[model samples]
Target: MKQLGSKIRGFFNTRLGFFALAVALFWAKTYWAYQTKFNLGVSGKMQNLLLVLNPLPTTILLFGVALYISGRKSYITMLIIDALTSLWLFANVLYYREFSDFMTFSLIKGSSSVSSNLSTGVMGIMRASDWLVFVDVAILILLLAFHVIRMDTRPIKKLFAVGVTLLAGLMFGSNLSMAYHDRSGLLTRTFDNNYIVKYLGLNAYTVFDGVKTAQTSATKANAKASDMNSVLVYLKKNRIDPNAQYTGVAKGKNVFIIHLESFQQFLIDYKWDGQEVTPNLNKLFHESDTLSFDNFFHQVGQGKTSDAETMMENSLFGLPEGSAMSLLGTSNTFQAAPAIMDQQGYTTAALHGGVASFWNRDNAYKSWGYDYFFSKSYYQNIKNDFLGYGIKDKLFMRQAAGYIEQLPQPFYAKLITVTNHYPYPLDKKNQSIAKTDTGDKTVDGYVQTAHYLDQAIGEFMAWLKKTGLDKTSMIVFYGDHFGISANHKDAVAQLLGKDSFDDFDNAMFQRVPLMIHMDGLKGGINHTYGGEIDVLPTIMNLLGISNKGYIQFGSDLLAANRNQTVAFRNGDFVSPTYTKIGSNYYDTKTGEQLKKLTQAQKEAVDAMTNRVTTELSLSDRVVNRDLLRFYTPNGFTKVDKSDYSYTQSKALEMLQAADDKNKTSLIDKNNGKSTMNEYKTDAPEMAGLKEFADSYSSSSSSASSSSGTTSASSSSATSDSSDKDK
Candidate 1:
């Protein structure tokens, strides 16, 4: 036993042996991260084995630097290096627990604000098991302290160190070659950071992130104020005049923007198994009070849903590569919907079921000048009412009703639904639609969840009518993005009975439902080529607000001479005549390649392409350089982010509503009782759930009348009122 111990000690005390041990420790931590935190998406055995082995070369090269010194200096240098690396891994572990994403250099630079803005009571996210991440470091420290592993006096030769580093470099080069062969453009076109960590390990991803951050910073620094003049001139030149007939048609009305998650336009009147897939949406779409667009497309990029939001709110494009909300949202200045409406005496708020910090929305919304933001913390019943994203659509709508009622009149509110998101999971009891046997489970399950979302919308609409909010509000419903991805194109083609699907079909599938419903409007189905970027300008026109002074990239869709060219983030665009993608132009009318073009046609296409590219580039520059800070519109006031605190917003809202008793607020009208019970849905998650019954039990029944007069219990009324008030 003594002999064995002596041999072990001797092995650990040598410089080469210690280097090997450091490499092994790094490998262990990398493996731990892969197993516990990262969603590497490794499918095959070979990929899994490669991931396990990928970290070795990088680790050896990094730890090899410690061999330059001998004795305690070398040992201490290695320890410090390992400690920092472990901390980096640990930080990523914590961040991935909440975001399911890796950290970037930009995120690390802004970590101070990120840490401060973390939602209160974050201890729930930290698990006792997470502490295991540091156990290896602790063991190493203990071994050093107890003299079980001694610091050697011998130094590694410089020649040997250089040879090992060169060997590691060669090994890493081989690894990259293999990764590139397996996943083409593994380093170049990696829009998704997860791909980097999966293919090349986290250390490589961090280095890449740092390089990208430096490039972004340099770009921002090099951007000149004079460059914005051309962008401004282009925007002014392209601006369209609002239609004389429809301008100010719904002025001073409450606006309810319902963001439908992952809903496609095909689902509007689509039928499954001889039954209507979205009966209520179909009814609304056909109603004379609703204006429905059949050709509205969602022009989102890698940011997807968040990109759609960015365009709808700011009349700007999302970044070409990553999410603008995640990368530039905290720092960029935006002349968004909330701020624009706020200029017209509109009280603006955003209600979402998910965490506000998911896409850094808590901070972004503040920058956008939202009067209030009711996120997951504001919801009353979300314990078991959640799926992968957040609270289920039915419960989220039902819970949102009370808060919606509390907002003052002339309010601009947005409700973001999440039930119909990717990997659409639905409770078996709630699924009323029969699944199609398309042989693809994801495509098959999509119908059920979309059907469930429709039901939730139906219930929310009914509540609006019951509470009389429908009478004063212009409800704008838009599908955020496509539910089904391109991976399921074959199955979708089979389901849709298409002989063969092409890029044209894929582009057409990007169409999402956009409907504007109000009581007094003469609504009709309009076939106009518009995208999410056009929504803000269109709505502003209807609300008697002019967006002429703002740096809007999109024109009002309701304008007579509206630019119908919809530019996608990836340099692709769709016009009335042609769809151009990567030097190839397809005739929109016939869906065929344009083999030949007249001089006029060529000039027109070139002009459109230039406009699209310029618009995207200008938007990127504005965001990346925070140019809005230097260029505020005529009627706009810069938002003070310090004025908003998502933590105390509920109390502030209640107090404000109570103070404005004579004004139109749902709380005052409902006699300080919640209207959650007025919302009814066939969601399976609500089965036998009676938690909302006692929400407003403390309020006296005899305090106020049904006429919405101020009541005695109004002082004790809170945002968490019971659903039993009905």
Candidate 2:
């Protein structure tokens, strides 16, 4: 029986069969459906898709080499590739918004592009069953890779198969364990793409419905049976009315929300040869009601700006453990600002300088309640230089002003700007002097473009003032994330004196500028540490709007009464609180803090986490059913301040302090103060940190020559930043 089985396997693993299959990939037409409903032209989507998948040639080369070397057929390898593609496709589509029509095999099977273009279903792979496709396909790929690769060597094949099967089993078992972990509530499954792909059998990069439905079901079930009320519930228990305290909301006013891409605190720190690069932003900070929360952090990094927007505008967070904004699944369940504002009877619109559907921002904006959406398509003519990502922030803001003017009575407009973005090159080739590289930019070019973008903002402010709209317009501007991640820390350290404060050395990514300007806003810099999550409640307070029993993670910044701002990551809190007077990040459950100077930050984060997760449990039911605006379902509960444990708090403190010490040490090392890491990762933070000492050392290109300072790049201004804007 064994001999016969071996013969059959050997027969199937011939070189000709392998070669035939390898050649077939070229013939197998992969039709990528138009991401946008409006057609660009023939082969437009295909060409763009190929460009997006630019590494394909390298991948094919690798496969070709592998086949030639190991005599492993490319066709056999394709089985693995196919499996992986399907798995990734499944994972990508797992989110409700991302999983459009072609995501389904039925839609893509016969078509040259995808199978379907449908964009309706659950929000994400919330349920546990969502992982099955990837896990199973991954298992098949490995089993087959070993089966084909070792067909010439029987013993090796057997051993490899066994080992792979065991590993897959272990991963599958661990995933099952996580799924069952009660503390994780309904989000304990393998929700992360990295985790699933690394351990599962095989994976495709496709976006399918991840384990979202199962998670929702389980969480809803858990919430239904729970006795605890989250902060929202607690707030309901002890509600406050802003109508009684402050004046009413700005009803007949125009609202401007500027979403700056990759705008982190480090940008200010990273100066262009000892000059504050962002003069306009610096000036705006002084003039605006700057709430400089010392310990504020982005809830979802660069990957989830929309999630941040959702949190900021609507006063809500997505599901506990996943990217609420990732366009993965079919169901459209985004946390939208315009939707809520629409509920308030406000004219709503979103403006950006990129394609409307790049991140499915248009679809997101549809339910987001934007009465109008102005994307790259709407622009009269865009400078399509090295349009790597999107367009200039200046153009976006300029267009946004026009949109705001078009709005009737009280309008809510979200304008996402791209300038001060990554590959922060300040040259003629990139961004038209919007400066792409954070380190060695052609300063004149960058400054010129930045000046232009800043002038745009200032000019808009001037316009508002001249039109008497300043009295009625509420402008909220903030950086989406850190720019380019180079020289930011050094710039900051140089300004603050790396030794000035131990806090700013590390986590420059978390450092962002947030300012709210309006006639009614009490102008002053509130240095209380906070993260992006705090913005929603802060806005609510400024607007004299109550928490609405929905937004629990945010705090009413206007309230003299105490409230905490919380944030989440990987289904748990890094530092949960933002209500503290000073900068510090702490875990509420373990009491293990990140920034230890203040205990208040940890408490606030913990309180916020408790509220957020508890709210999530309750929201599970309504999230799938309700529109984007009506998210925070009531009946949730927040733990009392006393409920926090001490040891957990202290541990977080120690970790944060240690982190601070380590970062300061690195900053010193980078600045010739101490020794540098022998092997540094080519990461944004490290690059930024490294630039502190060797600032602008990488500007060796003659075409991008440097004189007194780094010049702005000639590429699209804020293209990278605009991509992050929801």
Candidate 3:
């Protein structure tokens, strides 16, 4: 075999061999998955393990198959390179921990963990099955590449030559394609001079890509603060009440707002798998008016659950046009229920089982109007028996009960639960709640947590009954966001059952369990179009509160007038940028894009979109920070220091700091350790300088000197302006 020309040189230059290597090492990735499962530390959840095993193997297969179809050389380095590269891919996914986290059982809970290998194998099977076809293609490529590369003979020389030519062409094409994707700063300077010179009207040979960089920056700058306010005003002119109560919910009620961590809609199906998994939540909706907003969606223009909460609770919209949750707690002020209640004469309190401020929750809540904030420390020293992430629902519930008893007559208290958190790692060691025999993994943990929380809620409600405060109080309960993406898909599949993927069925993620349980309110399923933003106005409407001058994205959940939805892309990287109306997506940034919705429908949707945008901007900029004042779009009469959060550094310098100091806290005494928030909903909330934020949270008078409002707790939603926590 005589080699001539640049054939040998070309083969070495190509990455086809590396692709083959990746395929060979795909099987060995099992060890990585197993190691991550058990040794990810006490804080890690089973879900983290699940996240480890996703998509990498399949990608490895793709690399191998492409190489087999293209390359001429058979090599041992292929396997070695593949394993190393596969590990790299695994590490990246684990670091981001977004899609995978939602897919896996939480490692911290160890609910997904198993002492017995049999159960663990069953889960492993599921993870392995997802990549089976990819593996098959990879193995086939390796054997075939070996046979074809070393083929010998003379009469068959023509066929062999033809095969060789085609293989070389394929390899070259694949490499070129790969290069196209690596268009980073360094890459462009090195590779794409010709294309850059043409499209961008630049000198290809020059290293200065400054003009292109400036243009991209300018486009991003165009996404200004008012984008959020535009949505708010548009909402008033077209959708529900123009002026609605900004905050200050019903007083004296034990408001249990369990943002069921990653609680997706797929979990709600009445698929009594011989027994009901979510029997309590599903059944609760029966006695309560379940605001089953079928067309409602997540206003997540940016982060996942973090974005969902910011959009919903703050009555804000859009992501910060950058990374979501990364800039949490920094927003000066936003419309949170507690903030609203604080304005309308309510002593606000917040409770979550997680760390004090994982996602800047501590500072962010202070901006949201909570007078008292409670996290893991609030429930301190008690057996955090459940896991490293948070205390069990039962423990949280007990604390909530005590807080409720201490609250003034007209008070607001929120309790966010973690029992139903991923991997549903049941702390069955000491809990009194008897576990039901549910064979399904997802169903078992979900049901158990749901049931336990349900019992806790029921006990709380029973206490309210005993105190005689149950009749007048209004309670809002809903899942903050869906639990997992897979659960949402599975639910959609359950509806369609073994068919093509339905984008519309993606509702399980956006559509969650929402209910307003009040003594006088009618009980039944209210299957209207609604979402997180709409909850505020709906509650106000029921209480007969007049919100004539407020600016918010929410409408009365029970109101007859229908409202549309607006969406945000947590980390936007495109145009048409996922801005939408309810479930229907159309790109008419300046006009009504969806013809399916009539003039009224168009108005409703456009208005909502604008409102969501407005609220997001306003909250982000820290407007309407009056703790006692019900904030309107214009209600934010005074700018406080807290409302003007400054521009933060984009990179995680703290991670670098930890590296520099060689000081890390997560190392387990027994094994090892770990962790992960983002948002934007405001009316142009960015401050030119940090000095401007001085007056953000300043309220002139305590509730005592007010024309309306009680000292620590108001008697009711105070009608007087002085009650506003400005």
Candidate 4:
């Protein structure tokens, strides 16, 4: 034991031994962060092994450089490198906590804009345990100072240093190979940063992001005005004329886009424990003035909610991998919905209960040309009023009424609800309904949160009617994406009463509710199939606006000859006649996989697939190449992102200034009195508040006055034609 201890001490005396120790500590800390701080979605034995192994190659490669230097300088250099790398990891930890995403080069480059507010956010999310990331560095410095570990002044052999680096390179190659084997196109086609960090290490992801950012920059740099010609030609050739019946149906009306987070179509009239899951939504879907579509799917990729927003606003698809809003929207030119509405003298605003930095919405919204953005900062005194993603739906709606009333009449307002997000959570006091018996906690809680969201929407609708906005405005409620992933297939199958879940079932499960409610409109559930990409063109048509010269990939859903094939981000598509999931084709009507296909069916599938591919590829090109910069559609002006700011004071100042000048704001029309008290919510946190106490109730009966809103089964359009493509 004495001899072994002496030998260990002797090894620690060498500079190489110190480098080895530093590498071990760095690797250990990274693995700890992976397991504890980040949710990399690690699964399976292979994935687990990869997660454990990924950090080593980068750590070795980075630390191995110090081994080439000689003496005490090498030791000092090693510590410096360790500190800097640890700082990077620490930064990501804080960043991930706020955005649930890793930091990118663009975010780092734009750090000057956020440096003032970064400290407060950093401190707020920081934990005592986070200091542990640097504990090893502190310990190593102390060891050297106290002479517990002596550093030898001998120089490392050049050959030995080269061999060490070569070893690291080989390790990284093997690591990447395994990652690619586990998930094809892990680097190229991923939408979530977690996937990259899960398969590769954080350092690797950073390097990959830098390379991608550079490539995107290069693509935009070489882009020319002529590049937009082919895009324009394709859109013009494929454009569908608006249907006469629906044209100008909502001209000059205020538009409210309600983004239902993680909501799915099956929940609209679904029963859980003998009770309607979304009773209010079910009622709204059947209202005479409501145009609902059960075939509407959310065509979001890895960007999820952000992807849906991008598509709905700009008629653009998100990047095949990573979020376009985060990666490109900040700098890329956009003729978004807000910009379009702004051109028509409409006040454009987006309200969310989450932080502005989540998905980089603050910068992206600016690029989108919104006049105002009411993020979490705008809604103050949020004492336990939040859940998984952001503020509770009821509370958010109640608070948003103040901001909404302040907006000018005929404004375009986007309200994002987050209470129904993943891992749906509800306090005991807020649980007005029972959880489902799906056995899966995620599935069970989804019903409760969805019901809660419906209740909130119901109350908000009542407030809208009370304020007379409902009579003049059009409300569009659409789900962002699927709530439950295929990971909980068994629970989903049990809830859906299916024998087994397959790719076809998963494809169909992507359906999300799309309901457009406007007064004086005779409406029914449209059998036409469409996705989020169709929203912008449909809105433009309804508003009596022509988007003829714009580079939109979607056509008006109300058009008689509109395309019915909805394409997903992953090259899969669904049409009225057939659905393609992975490499398999299925009959849309029968839900039967078509292993044997007739020549006609095969030809049809091939044509649809080609169209989907073309559309997605074109959208990708437009965004990646920043093609909008080269083309300005007729009657459209390029958006100046610098003209917008989302700070609380700035937003209020702009709103007040606009209202004073035009007298068109709803609050101005109402004689400048605050209408905050007019809004009500059943949120538990509002119970003690005297002003809202009278209006708050556990039951959602207040919003029942919307005619024909019943908790009955969905009303089918008996005579509606299913073939809209013709």
Per lDDT, the best of the predicted structures is 4
TM-score of each: 0.72, 0.54, 0.54, 0.73
Q: What is the C-alpha lDDT profile of model 4 across 1-726, one tens digit per residue?
A: 999999998998887788888888888889999999886657689899999999998888888888888878888888998999899999888777644568877566544434433343366468888888998899889989999999899888989999999999999999999999988888765545778899889999989989977887798889888888778788888888877788888999999999998899999889977899889999999998898998999998657788899999999998765678877778889999999999998999999877678788999999999998887666644357766566789988887776677677779999999888766778998898898787876578888889999999999999998889998898999999888876567889998999888778988999999999999987899999999999999888888888888888888888897889999887789999999875579999999989999999999999998888888878988998998988888899899988998765556666666766676766666665555556767677977777333332211122122221111001112101111111
Note the Cα lDDT for every prediction shown: 0.76, 0.43, 0.43, 0.81
| Best TM-score among the predictions, by candidate number | 4
Model 1 CA lDDT for position 100: 45
- CA error at residue 168 for candidate 1, angstroms: 14
Q: Which portions of model 2 miss their true places by more than 4 Å?
A: 1-246, 249-251, 268-270, 288-295, 301-303, 319-336, 343-345, 382-386, 425-452, 484-508, 544-552, 571-726
Candidate 3: tens digits of C-alpha lDDT, residues 1-726: 346535643443335433433433453444343333212211134233323433233334334433343233323434444444444434323322323221111111222211222232234224443343245346635644765333211122345435544654564445334334432332332212223222211111122333443443454445445444544455556566522332333433434455655555554644433555455566556675333443354445324555566655655543332222334344343555566665665556667655554555656665665666655543323322334246566555544443344344455667777666555566555333444333435434555566555555565556555545566566666776654443334434543354543333343335567766666555677655556666666665544544455555566666655544433332111112233422344443443335476677567555655544444444443322221223344443322425322111111122123222432111111012110000111112222422212111111011112221111122112212222221
Off by over 4 Å in 4: 1-213, 596-602, 668-677, 691-726
Candidates 2 and 3 compared: the better one by lDDT is 2
Models ranked on TM-score: 4, 1, 2, 3
Output the better candidate (2/4) by TM-score. Answer: 4
Each prediction's total of clashing residue pairs, residues at least 3 apart in sequence or on different chains, is: 2, 133, 82, 2
lDDT for model 4 comes to: 0.81
lDDT of 1 by residue, 1-726 (tens): 999988877898888877788778778977887887665557566567669878887788788888877777877787787778778888777666544457776665544433432432135346677767667677777888997777777867889989988988998898888778777766654445666777788888888888877887888778777867887888878778977788899999999999999899999889989988899999999999998999999988756677889999998988755678777777777899998898788888898877667677888888888888877656654335666666788878776665566676778999999888756777777778988778876678888888888889899999889978898889999998887766466878987889877767777788999999999898999988999999998899889898888988888877786878898776678977889854468889889988798898899898887778788888877888778877888878888777766764454544354336545667557766656566776766666656443342222222122332212124223323321121
Quote model 4's TM-score.
0.73
